[model samples]
Target chain A: MLKIDELEKCYRNKEKRSIFHTTKSKEEKKALDGINIDLKEGQALACIGENGAGKSTLIKCALGILSPTSGSVRLFGEDPRRNKKYCMQKVGVVFGQKTNLWIDIPVIESYKAVKQIYKVDNDTFKRNYEMVMELLELKDIIDVPARRLSLGQRMRADIGLVLLHGPELLFMDEPTLGLDINVKYTIRKFLRQLNQQEKTSIFLTSHDLDDIDEICDDAIVISKGKQIYSGKLDELKNVYADKHIIKISGMKTGNILSLFPGVELTEKENQSIISWDKSCYSVQDVISGVFRMYAVDDIEVREPDIDEVVSRIFTEGVSI
Target chain B: MKNFWTYLKISIKSKLYYRTSFILNMISPIIVLCGQVLLWKGIFKLNNASDFADMSRNAMFSYILIAFVLNNSLNWSTENSLSKDIRNGTVVSKMIRPTTFLSQNIADMFGGVLIQGLFYTLLVIVIFFIAAKDLFVPSFSNLLLFVLSAILGMILRLMINDFFSLLCFFVTGYLGIAWLKNAITNFFSGAMIPITLFPVTLKSIAGYLPFKYMIQVPISFFLGEYTFADGIKTYTVQILWILFFIILHCLIYRKIRINLVIAGG
Candidate 1:
């Protein structure tokens, strides 16, 4: 479990004074401002933000890698700044851009080193090592040096290394960034299964919306160092995803727009795509009306995905 | 202790991973050692004497050989490596683990130097056996003292290097700091020239500094130049200096953690 209350972090500018400008600048830039998050046991929380939105900063502050300027952060009911070793013993962190594995050594060697570093006993090390190896599918690359592996392979090895100690919580920053679609899905599935079966709490920050959709249930949206939205992921989708798209392909669909009062339609060839706000028009009524009045060969309905909902929130400044 | 050994093992494995580089590094030191020996021999030849500064020709050669081996043993690029880690934000990996940063760096230094140290030490023994069997062989007690002092010296060197390495957090580059550290340490520690050959004033000043203990004093113990009383006095100073740097590192690191700006995500 983790608790962060009104956490704020500010970085001072390191501007050199010129001969013409003798006075030093004392300006401080806030990377995180009055942000709060409480992640319960076994809860997977997604920190959604764009580049430079202070999402990484928040994770660093919570991990005691960077001290907060103000407010407090507690990991397992202890201040991480003062008790980093104690908190870190139960925590696993994976920085997607950076590697935790020793680059020149085989991935298996790094895993063995982790076992000694964390003082994991033989039995537990064996069990966790086997589980991580199987789940991360590290059989082929385990003996290769980390520097020789691809980004996806290295990331998988890193994740496996951290889990060898059986950490109670895992903090991942863009775990699937820059990976192929298959690799991304593999990582996401591995993480989801870990959360579901092992009950390891996950605090994930990623630009990839699908990672969030697959791995996290609760979500907090950060923009400009501010917590703009915090609630259930489903609720966030429902709130900003108010519009639905209905695509119907037929020969004569030019007059479909005239039948619906507030629907927008675009026709290309034999396909007519109808879009409308669900709050204004009942989907069932509209579908029945179009079915009765128009000749339709094929029809399909689509709801807004998390990616579209998040884009809308950012562009429209939707907050709750 | 477990973490320390784990780090040491991993560091050794990494250093040995690149065979060409490791072999090259091992051979480079021998070339430097031979070059230094020839240079010193030429200096003695030019002086037209079998002794300089109360050291006979054989004693001076032995001193050079031992110093070369000891200096190579203590050499660690902690500052450069740490500065790189800090600049690139890879230092976070070390910080997040449940191990002390100082111990980890110390292990890495030892791991890196272990192979070279052993090789050079064996080379020295072989050279002494073939060239000068009776050249400055210390008594058993003195050899024990020398071994203890040398271990402490290695630790002292690591502590000093780490102290300078931590300054990378505040600076953009480490070149200047490293140059300054090397110049000061080499001059005062007698790694460049034995403090015994210095002018009276310079030698006295070196006597008061911690750098002398890092190289000259330990060599003194190995050469049987230090009495029991002298060994005790030198050790007291070495321990105090080690403690000083350790405390300073702890204080500075505490401040650094608060202001640490990891360069990249």
Candidate 2:
């Protein structure tokens, strides 16, 4: 479990003042401000944000890698800043862009080093190593040096190395970045199982919305160093996303435009797509009206996906 | 301690993985040692001097060989590596580990130099046996003393290097800092030239500084230049300097960690 309250981090920025740059000034740039999060054991939370939006800074603060400018972060009910080594014993972190495995050594060697470093007992090491190897599909790549591995292979190796100690909490910053869809899916599935079956808490940040959609139940949206929304991913889509799209394919699609007033409709050769605002018309009423109007070959209703919902929240500055 | 050994093992394994590069690195130092020896021999022949600074030609040659080996044992740019890690953001991996930063870096430094250390050490023994058998051999007790001093010297060197490497966190570039450290260490530690050959003023200055303890003091013990009492005194000073650097390292690291910034996400 982890808790962050009013956690703020400010970095000093140096600015050159004169044309010759003889004078300089120091300014404070807030990387994170008034951010709060409480991740319980076995809960997987997605931290959604734009670039430079302080997601990584928040993780560093929580991990005691960076001291917060104000407020506090507690890991397992202890101030991480004061007790970082103790807190880190039960914590695992993976930066997708950077590797934790030693680049020149085989993946298995690095895992063994991690085992010794974390003082994991032989039994625990064996159990976790087997589970991680099986779940991450790392058996083939285990003997390869990290530098020779492809990006996906290296990432899988990194994840396996981090899990070899059976950390109670995992902080992953873009764990699936720059990977093919297959590898990403594999990693997400592995993480989901880790959370659900093993009861390990996950705090993840990524630009991939699908990663969030598939792996997390709760979500926190941040933009420009501030938390904009924090709640269930389902509620985020339902509340912020007002438009429901319906596609109807039939021979008589020409007159569908005038049938529904206030609803946006796009007519094609054989298909008519209706964009219905939930505020203006109920989905049930719209579907019934469409069915009563004409014979349809096929009709499908689609709610906004998480990608659209999150993009809307960011662009429209929606907050709750 | 277990973490330290593990990191050391990993570091050595990583280095050995690049088989060609590791072999080249090991051989390159021999070329430099040979060059230095030839250059010194020319100087001695040109001057037509049987001895320089009260050391015979064979003694000085032995000094150069031993010094070269010892210097290579401590040859690693901790600052360069640390700064690169800081710049590339790989330092975050180190920060999140369950071990302290000091232990990891120390293990890594020693591990990186271990192979070279063993290689140079064997080279020195072979060269001494094949080419310089007439060179003075220390008593077994003196050899034991030399080993102790050399171990302490290695510790002292690592401590000094670690202290300087921590400064990389405060600077954007480590080249200037590393150059300064190397210049000072090379000049004062007698790695480039034995302290016995230094002028009175330079020798006194070296005595006041801790760098001499890292190289010259241990080599002095090896060559029986120091009495038993002198060896004891040298150790006392080495331990004190090590203690100083340890305290300074801890204090500076604490300050640096407050402002630690990993360059990339």
Candidate 3:
């Protein structure tokens, strides 16, 4: 539903040579370095990157909030900048720290205002408003002034407002950041349900790795404004999931590192662990070997969580 | 039109959310009006020329009252809102909305004027009518002229304010500049004193500036200083200035939009 080509956003920093003299200087900070990506209809793409990696800049360009210094962004078949109204009608964006609802106004009033801005018909407005309020559990807080609501409540209200108009494309930046665990789970569940029911195309950014794992079907990892990896979530897990740690509480340490030529041993006070790098041996073969060499009491091997995988990618700075 | 009603409702709800603020807000304008009345009354007594240009103490008070109302009605601080939106990055989402920013701001202004300006105007009119009954009462025709001129003047002021506010898209830290513009407009627009009280040369110069239309022209119409022909000429000039500023505002906004794209704001 969205396509970008060679998008680069650059800012010129003007410096004064001297206060009295008439000389000027300049430097450029290129926030995004020629990023290109496409999102298929109904696909949830999570943009993973560090701060200042140009993720926000890239989103702004796609939403036509900021014009790219170079390159083009197209929503559907048309340029977003040129057909801004049509593009706006097809997109719903939630800024991490900013709520579009007027602060001192009641939540319902803000929704009414959004309805007018989107020009929704009466029946659709009524039906969607009820559905959104019910889905977000905002019916009770709908009459409360937005300023009086908690951040989590406000976030839900803001999301409800975005869904009121039923935009096909949704942009959620750090939606779960700073939110409590319960709120995060509620938002994640609602997002999954919305995507399933409406077939909405979601572009989400989150510092919470669990959020990405729960809802994202596809992922793109960018670092320092460069796209390092783009593929299905499972594919990333397979390609990068080389090692599986079998945590065994055995009171024995027979140079566990010597089990395999390349195995890394991690020993605790009463436990010894070894990582079976898939590059060296299959899980079944490693298990069989461990059974033969040492008494295996209990063992459980599983894929590393997204947090570990992402931390590795960042710390290792691997190039995909 | 639906958005207009919705915005008005939201604005009202927003303003009423803080009862203390609403009460304090109502008191502020009255205090300002009293200050002006005292300052101008002192000047008129000292000059001992209350009847100059057919302007008595009562006429002067009436003119000041209307001028105060008109000034508040025309008060549109573009710099404040623009700078805030920029700092918060909320302007990004605002731009993505299908509504025009100018229209939204103008609608906001109407809401403000209705809630704050109308409250002050009504309160002052009631207080002045009782306490300063001798102040030259407005004729129906003068009232009509005053209303039209004030509306046009507000439109012109909004255009000018919007133009200056758009400068934030390029210039950094313009809070002081916006305040300076407001101060200049307040002084020269006749919110402080009638332009007629100024020296002839200054009054003639102020006559041409859009600032004068915002207060002086509207006040003069209410004070019955101008005949129908003179009122027409004065208002026609003011309307032309309003049209010019509106066009200028749109042109500059378009240019600054392009500049924003280039500068990556």
Candidate 4:
């Protein structure tokens, strides 16, 4: 439901002259360079990038919060800036660092305010509000002021506040930022369920890989404001996930290293870990080979984590 | 309208959230009013027959009290909160809404003025009523004009404040701007001293500028100092200035969208 073509954004920086400065100098910095992207209807797209990678810049330009220095963004086949009111009606946005709810009001009061502001009819409002509160587990804390809520509680409330309007598309910037594992898991599962049941298109940008695995089907990797990889998440994983982890107990690192000519082995208390390219040998073959060579113990074979794959892609480039 | 009311309710609820702080805020304005009362009464007594102007002592007191209330409303601090919204990216919340910047600001002003400023003004008014039974109660016609002028004055203040709030995007100087506005309005809107008290050139400058209409003219109309013709002329000028700032707010907002629009910055 969103399209960006050759998007380029340049920010002008004025020199921070001295305390008694005389002249004004300007420098142009490129925040986004030649970005082209399209997100189809009902697809949850993950924007993978480190900080300052222009993910926010791209989203802001699409949402019409920021005017692009060049190129165009079309949402639902119309310019977001031109049809902002109509577009915003169907769009829900959340910034992890900020809240849309009133600072000192009960969570439910904020929900009621959302219902009023969106002009939702009473029946629909009741149904949606109850559903959101139940799904987000907001009932017990609904009467508590937002200022008193924990970060996780507040993020859930913020999500529910936006979802009360039943938006067709949701944009979340770092939605799981600085959150603990339990809260992050709750949000990830909630988002996945919402996307599945409602067919809601989601645009999510986060550094967390588990969130990506749980909620998103499509992936776009951005590095230095340039599109590096834009395709299926599994394909990105398969290409970069070539190594497998093997942990063996009752084995010495010296014996394992001698068996394999050029393998990196790490040893812990009673176990040795060996990492090797899957392309070089199959897991079954390695298991049999290790069993034939080594005596008694336990062995575990694990696939490389998605985070490791992504980190490799980021550091090693898209050369695989 | 429903959205604005909801926002207004929520805003007032926010102010009322800290009950003790809310009560504490009511004291400062009353204290300031008492000081202004002492200072103005002493000046009148020191002037003896009031040789400086044709205004009377009762009229001067009424002007001061009414202008005190009006100035309090005019200089309400929506811009300070707006600057925070911009800095912290909470402005994106407003952007995601169906409303414009002006609507959001108007809702905020209603919250700040009708609660934060009105409480103190009402307390001081009660003190005034107990102290002076024979003092000014505006006539029906003056009351009608006063209400209209005050409404427009509020809109004008919001527009001016929103305009400068937009400057926060470029300058990042909210405190300086706020103090400058406070100083200028105090000097020009005549909360501390009426424009009649100013020398000839300063009075002429006040006449051309819009700050007097915000506080001084409203008081003049309330005090029955302005004739019907004079009131209508001044109201028309105030309306024109309101329209000017409304357009100016839109222009400045466009500039902000072009140059600012911070998200996760």
Candidate 5:
């Protein structure tokens, strides 16, 4: 539903000038560099990278909030820049920190405003308002002013505002960030359900691995404004699947060190965490041998988190 | 039209959401009006002409009261708000909306004017009527001219304000410029006093300038000072300004948005 071709964006440093303002600085920051991406209809894509990854910049380009320095973005065969109104109707975007609803307005009133902005009819307004409020579990607080609600409550309302028009493409930037576990889970669940039931295409950028695991079918990793990886989330996981974390308590550091070869040791007094590359040795063999060598009080082994894998790809340059 | 009403209702609800702040906003205007009334009354007494060389003390008092209400109601603050919106990222949401950003802004402005202007101006007019009974009531024809000129004046004022606001997308910190524009406009526009009281040069200069049409011309038309021909000529000037600024607003909007997008590049 979204296609970007050879997109490049460079931001000029207007604030930086030569002495006496007679000269302009040629210095510029590349926010997006020759990136090509396509998001299929009804597919949920997750964008993961460290800070300054240009994830937000890329999304803004797609949304026509920022024009690419070169190339172009097309949403369903129309230029988003020229056809903002039509494109906006087809897409819903929620910036992580900004709530679209006015803080002093009640949730319902804000929804009404959105409804009018999108020209939703009375019947649709009622239906969408009811459905969104129920799905977001915001029935009780829908009449309350947005400023009076907690962050989580406001976020749900923000999502509700986005969905009022039943947009086919949803660009969610860390929608679950800073939410409590229950709210996070609820949002993740809602996202999954929305995508599956409505065939909504979602472009999500989040730091939450759990959100990615719960909702994304495809994942794209970018580093320094360049795409590093793009494919199935599991495939990307497999590519970075060499290491397994083994947390061991009641094992002496020296003894644990002796048990495994090529194991990266993380020690803390009586506790030690071992990162064993499965490529060098099977995690099973390493853990079993460690269990036999030390008097093990407790041990837990799990795959490396998606965040760690993605961060490694972003910061460690996909070499290690 | 539905969007307009929806925006109006939402704005009102938003304003009322902070009940304390809403109360304060309403009270601040009233307090400022009271101060203006007191100062104007003081000036009248010190002028030592209860009859004021043809303009009665009662007429001047009512004129001051209405002038205060009109100045408060007619002036627009959207320039500062628009500047802040640009500085912050709130304009992004408005950009995403199906409506044109300019239309959305105009609706918001009208909403504020409708609610705050109507409420506050009504209060001021009621108080003026009760406090000063025999100031001046225009003939029906003059009343008609007054209302027409006032409407035209309001449109001109908003156009000017919105035009300045569109400049925010160009300059850094245009709020200061917007404020200075407002102060200068209000001072020369005779929103505080009729232009007739000014020096001959200023009065003549004010006669030709569009600023006078914003307050003095309209109120003077109400006072039956302007002949029909004179009223039409003044209104034609206000309309010309309205058209000029409307075009200016559109041109600036396109230029600014393009520049902003390019700069973002």
Candidate 6:
């Protein structure tokens, strides 16, 4: 549903101002460097990037908020910049830090205003409004003014207002930033349900890895404005899932450590924890070899999570 | 158009949200009205001149009241809010919305004027009528002319203010630009003193600027200074200046979008 081709955005340096003289000096800094992406309909993708990796810039360009210095973004089949109104009609955006709702007004009033702005049909508005309020749990706080809402409540209202129009696609930029763990889980759960039940496509950018792990199946990892990885989250897991630890419960006299002297092993609480690079040893090897040598009471294999996978990708500066 | 009306309703609602602030808002204008009236009354008294700049003592009193209301009605500051939105990056929300930026902001101004300006204007009119009953009744013909001129003047002022607000896209701090705009409007638009009372060169300079149409020409019509032909000429010139500012706004908006620098991510 969305295609970004060779997208590059450069910001011009501000002019130097002085009383005596003004100079025509221009310096350009590229925010996005040749970003290429393709998102199919109903596919939720997480855009993983560092703080200055031009994630927001890429989203703004796709949304037609800021014109790209070069390249083009197409929503459905039309360029958003050329067909802005039509493009915006099919998309919902939630800016986590900045509010989309009107301040000094009740949260529900802002939702109603969004209804007018988007020209949402009554039926669609009602269905989405009820679903969003219930999922986001915006029941008691709907009457309160937006300025008085807590960070989580306001973010909920922001997301709900955009969803009120029943957009086909949602672009959320750091939707869980500054939210408490409980609030964060609530938002993630709301998004997961919205994607699963509604078949709504989501393009999410976040620093929180768990959000990506829960809501998105595909991920595009960028660092320093370059797209390094674009593939299935499971594929990244496979590539970065080199660290595997197996814990075996045994008495102190098992002498398992002496057998696997070449491998790294540690013990605690009557358990022999054997750690090794998955490239060096397999789970079958551990079961066949470690079990026979030691008094293996229990075996537990630990696979690395998405967060660890992403941390390794960034640390190693690996590109796909 | 539907969006415009909706925003107008919300704008008016926002204006009325702070009750204590509105009370204080009303008091400041009344104080300014009192001070300007007394100062003009003292000046006319000391000079022993029945008329200044072809305006009689009664005309000046009525003019001050009318000018005060007109100025208050146009007090919506597009710069302050627009700059805040830009700095905070919430303006990104506006960029993503279906409506253009100009339409949204104009709707916001209409909201501020219709709701906030309505009650204050009504109160000031009642007080003026009680204090100067004899001068409150302008001929219906004059009232019609004043109303038409005022509407055009408002559009012209909105164009001007929108122009300044767009400058916030380029400049870091809008305080200097905002103060400069207020200063120019107060002096050149004759909100502080009648344009006719100015020396010849300054009057000629004001004649060429759009700020004059925003206040001076409209007030001149209210004080019976403009005949039908004069009214026609004044509106023609004001319309031309309005067109000029519209073009200027378009040009500046294009440049701003090209260099669109939203402060926060």
lDDT of 3 at B129: 68
lDDT of each prediction vs. the true structure? 0.86, 0.85, 0.76, 0.79, 0.77, 0.81
- Span of 10 residues, lowest total lDDT, candidate 4 chain A: A251-260
Docking class of 5: acceptable
Classify candidate 4 by CAPRI docking class: medium
Error of 2 at B19 (Å): 1.3
Weakest 10 consecutive residues of candidate 4 chain B by summed lDDT: B71-80
Report how closely model 6 matches the true complex, as a DockQ value.
0.71
Candidate 6: where are CA atoms >4 Å away?
A: A15-25, A247-261, A270-273, A293-300, B76-79, B131-137
What share of the reference contacts survives in each candidate?
0.81, 0.78, 0.59, 0.66, 0.53, 0.67
Preferred candidate (TM-score higher): 3 or 6:
6
Encode model 4's per-residue lDDT on B22-124: one tens digit a residue: 6666556667878988987888788886533877777777777887777665334344788667666677788778776688877876787888556656765
**Which 10-residue window of candidate 1 chain A scores lowest in summed lDDT?**
A250-259
iRMS per model in Å:
1.1, 1.3, 3.2, 1.4, 3.3, 1.3
Residue-level error in angstroms, candidate 4, position A266: 4.9
Best by DockQ: 1
- Model 6 Cα lDDT, one tens digit per residue, B1-265: 8888888777777767777876676677778888998899899999899887787888888778777877777553433576567667777877788887777877877676675457766876786668765354567788789888988898888778878877777777877778888899888988888888899999899887889887788877877778788888888887888888888887876666566867767
Per-residue CA lDDT of model 2 for A1-320, tens digit only, reads 79999988888766656576577677888888999999999999999998889899899899988888899899999987678778999999999999999998888999988888889999999999999888889989999999999999999999998998899999999999999999999999999999999999999999999999889999998899998888898898888788998898776633544667888878888788889778888788888878776588999987578888878877887776
Q: Per candidate, chain B TM-score?
A: 0.94, 0.94, 0.87, 0.91, 0.86, 0.93
TM-score of chain B of 1: 0.94
Interface RMSD computed for candidate 4 is what? 1.4
lDDT of 3 at B127: 67
RMSD of 6: 2.7
Best-first order by lDDT: 1, 2, 6, 4, 5, 3
Q: What is the TM-score of chain A in candidate 6?
A: 0.90
Query: How would you encode candidate 5's per-residue C-alpha lDDT over A43-115 as one tens digit per residue?
Result: 9999887777888788878987666789889987898878988999889998766778877777877887787
User: Where does the lowest 10-residue lDDT sum fall in candidate 5 chain B?
Assistant: B256-265
**Residue pairs of candidate 1 with colliding backbone atoms:** none
Instruction: Give the worst 10-residue stretch by lDDT in candidate 2 chain A.
Output: A251-260
Against the true structure, what is each candidate's TM-score? 0.93, 0.93, 0.88, 0.91, 0.83, 0.93
